[model samples]
Target: MAQVLEFKLPDLGEGLTEAEIVRWLVQVGDVVAIDQPVVEVETAKAMVEVPCPYGGVVTARFGEEGAELPVGAPLLTVAVGASAADTPGPGEVPARDGRQDPPASVNGNSRPAAADAPGGAAEGSGNVLVGYGTGTAPARRRRVRPAAPATPASSAPPARPSPVPPAPAPTVAAVPGQDASRGEGPVPVISPLVRRLARENGLDLRELHGSGPDGLILRADVEYALRAAAAQGRTAQAQAVVAAAPAVAEPQPAVPASAVAPGGTRVPLKGVRGAVADKLSRSRREIPDATCWVDADATELMRARAAMNASGGPKISLLALLARICTAALARFPELNSTVDTAAREVVRLDHVHLGFAAQTERGLVVPVVRDAHTRDAEGLTAEMARLTEAARTGTLTPAQLTGGTFTLNNYGVFGVDGSTPIINHPEAAMLGVGRIVPKPWVHEGELAVRQVVQLSLTFDHRVCDGGTAGGFLRYVADCVEQPAVLLRSL
Candidate 1:
């Protein structure tokens, strides 16, 4: 006997609620082993391959690729205790009463009815996602068939045919111009993507009739409704223009070019892009942040990097040197390396430095955190940073790698620009921005000389420290950049 088990999208951690199906690894009727990655999904944080807990034959897949499904929504169904030979062929399912029933397709994919095996127990891998674990399959409640009323033929009443034929029951699709408010209960919607589309376009879900099973609203139905509404609006506008035309012509005021132009391309802020927008927006809204900048002569820092690379060892990156300075400065000015706890009305200072650096990728801007940065030397920092940068570029960074930062070091200089007051990565107290090092005339030891100069800016949460503390931290970082020997005292 084969038992069908359902697998859902698991919690990917870090408060992520949903994910978009990127690709499916297995299809209907394919055999799978325990812990095999069944599907690849892109969450707001990163791209992840989700694994199945049961070893079985895949019976159905829930959503199509590119469809967004909430956590805990069904991802697929599997028939456990069945071999490849025992598994029914496509479009056929083993019935509960020992018969084969034709399978039905949902969203253009075949799905068989799920049922548990009688008196058969199946084991599963205990590891899935956080908060979900393996256990004995719960018994499924069976529906009891009601018995027909029994009566003697003589006692039974004879039925007569009615003069008028009976009317058909109302369907899921409501009649046009019908009052949506009059309908009872919740609207029939299963996919969150459909709801989001309707909400974004300001379309009321109640007003449109669904074309799916039992009047369930599908994505196609919502799109059709939106198109109809847009066409209706355009027609009304044309009618109004004709109605306003006058017999005696009066010159109309000139419309602005922006007003007359067609709408531009609209790129949805979602996934990584959406997450960045949300975090940056919250930082601006909640934290009272201030920025301070200073120009430092980086001739010595650059020379030190060159000297290290000249010696035969793993090449030291300029970013690693800056990160070393940041960690040392944070050690002295611990106030800048903490976060403000708004609810408790307190400033929570972190002991360890999980330093995050900004990396630009094809997807969007992502910050990958280097754990215990304070404990690592220049060489260690360089290796870890290189690994994280490669991961970010490949879109293989995990959620854990992207979060839990105490401070951020943003090297926007790679963009070839001189300086920018970077927006602080939120929840974290501060962010240090580094500009390009270029030759500039400066007073060096009482003489006007051309030296390598770089601009460094620090943006801090004002609640954590005052301007004097912020200025002191920036000055220390600048000193280290100018005279690499200044870092020796901390070491």
Candidate 2:
């Protein structure tokens, strides 16, 4: 006997609520091993390969590739303890009377067999995502069959429980301003993203019909309704303007057709792009920030780096040296290394520095944080940054590696640009921006000289520190650039 088990998508941590299916690794009727990678999904954070905990034959899969599924949605079903002859063929399902039948069962029961049952098929690897366990299976809901016409007592057959349970019907929540007379129940929406879209656009979910299974409202449905409504409104407004126009109006200059019907490619802000948009928007909205910049003569710093590499076992990167200087400067001006707690009305200074560096990848801009950066030396920081850069380029960074930074270092110089007032990474107090180091005319030791010059900008939250502190930090960094020995005093 085979026991059919349902496997729902587990919660990927770090406050992620949903994921878009990128690809499926297994197909129906494929025999799978425990903890095998089943599907690849892209969340707001990174690309992840989700593994199944059960070892069995895949019975069915839920969402198609490129479809977004909320957490806890069914990913697939597996039939455990089934013989090779019992497994259905690829893309085939057992049906009766031209209708699909419920899953097969074990021992006349719809639920999964106990973990200690024969063959121990119900036992799982217990390696699901955080907060999800496979120790015990959840109880199945009983399927509610429709009532049949009453028959004579002599002709009625003996009643027995169904072999497998049916999936529960979609539930809805009552929508405000809904007409009670229509007898419609609450709106059937399961995705928070769908609900947020409808709410933000003031579109009533009750007015639109869902095209998903069980009439569950999806994001596409709300988007289609909003688009149709906009087109209708535009049509009505155009008609009204034409009717109000005077019959003998003076002729006006002709407008370009391009202006009348604007056309261009529309790229959706989603996944990594969407997440970056939300964070940058929030930073601009919540932080009252200011920027200060200074030009530093970096001839000495470059020479020092060359000398170190020439004599070193492991080559030290220029970014790592700059990071070392930042940590040292923060130690002197600790106020810049803290965040503001608006709710508590306190400027909470952090005890340790988690330094984040901006790395642009094919996916988008990402900041990978290095934990306890204040404790690492230049070589260590270089190694860690290289590892993170590779991970970011390959789209394998975890959510934890992408968040929790107390300060940020953004080196836009690699782009061959000179100064920029960078927006602070929110919740953190400040960001340091470094620009290209080029040879330019400078007054050194009271004489004209050509030296390597780099521009450095510091953007700080005005609430945490005033212009005096920000200037001092930038000045210190400039001093270190001109004379690398100044950093040894702090060390």
Candidate 3:
């Protein structure tokens, strides 16, 4: 007799609460081997592909594409013993502690699980649906970083006067007007972006003067310092980076004359795109919305990215950078980090930055949650982003990766668009839209020349986030991108 098992969505890590089905790699009735990727899922950090916990003939597809499922929700059923050599042992206990289990006895060293059994390990051990399990289940323990919002990088904007410069040499301050200290002291007001830039490039803000409004150091000043310092580090490296995504599909204009109505093929919208349409329409009508934007040039950031990759760092996408930047900006604008409390008739401000990265999958548009992005550094963020994006593309994303985001980032620059105004994910007060970076003529050292330019769009709730705060937040982000070093100070 064939034994049956139920597979449920497990925590994908970083406290993910839900995930949306991007697509199913295997169809019903397809025989699947243990650890064979069965589905692709979209989480906040990235797209992920999930392997089957139990090998068997897929008997049922319990969830639909574009559907958001909770942790432990039944996903599908598999018949473990349908074929010879696939039979389960009598009285086989479901993996009680799959996390602590060893590999199976099979020569392939697979982890074995009776696919049709109940309460199968949601995350799965090495042994699964195949007659035998292979490899150990991936480690389940996650590294926990200290809980604190990241500080914004202060370098994306044009340079301003230093409003908070330190005393030159300490000795000059005690004896005024004796040497270089004789001139008006350099302003020291540094934005989050500037502080980070200073640290990364070993720049002393006191050495360079800011010319921005109110003495705030803009990204230009940092770039200048970086140029003066690097010579080589800035130009030899450049790579593609992430930015915000724009609005929905445009209205169809006149149909092309070449194709007469033999009849337009009716493609049913399901999955990620379909889900995005449903939820975004609902949000537009039900939730009050507003937006603000600031252009950002990530030229320096692109350089930094190249340097990091060359140094054997994780391969990170531009989406990861926007997520990290927004995580930092949220700390200075916490009101945007909130949810609408239907039961309380008030907004609940979230202490942690549960960030959502909007991803497109065959199923539809889904926003996956990254529990606390502020806690992760660039390397960690890069790794998680890869994992999530892979899961999304492969149809194995877990349900928990889809829920509870305090803010969302929609990046479209991957396709090479310049900019767009993205909608806010409901309940959260704001969303960030990033666009492609292109070369533009900009003034450097008081001379006009080509530099990288990009645009940013910020949509926020009118009730909670005001224009000034939202605008300031965008400015903060812009400053960081233009001057990648600002991240050092914020950390």
Candidate 1 TM-score versus the reference: 0.72
Cα RMSD to the true fold for all candidates: 12.4, 12.3, 31.4
lDDT per residue for candidate 3 within 1-491, as digits (tens), equals: 67677566767785555566767787656689998888776654346777778987765444445544545555666777685234322223324344443332222112222333222222222111122222211222221211212222321221223336622211101122323421343333322334567668766654554444222345555665555334323222211111122333322223223234544676633334555666678778766887777766677888877787788745766677777788888887888888777677787888998888876776456676777888987677777877777676665566567766788888777768867767677767788888778898877669988888888888888777678888888888888898877766777
Give the winner by lDDT: 1
* Alpha carbon deviation, residue 438, candidate 2 (Å): 1.3
lDDT of 1 by residue, 386-454 (tens): 999999998889999999999999999999888888788989999999999899999999999999999
Question: Which ranges of candidate 3 are over 4 A from the true structure?
Answer: 1-266, 362-364
Cα deviation at 369, candidate 2, in Å, is 0.4
Q: Candidates' TM-scores?
A: 0.72, 0.75, 0.50
The residue pairs in collision within model 2 are: none
By TM-score, the better pick of 2 and 3 is 2
In order of lDDT, best first, we have 1, 2, 3
Report the error of model 3 at residue 275, Å: 2.5
Which residues of candidate 1, in runs, are more than 4 Å off? 88-186, 190-263
Per-residue lDDT over 91-189 for candidate 2, one digit per residue giving the tens place of the 0 to 100 score? 333432432233332111122111232122222211111111122122222223222233344322222123356233212223434433213433445
Whole-model alpha-carbon lDDT for candidate 3: 0.59
Model 1: residue 180 alpha-carbon error in angstroms? 11
The candidate, 1 or 3, that scores higher on TM-score is: 1
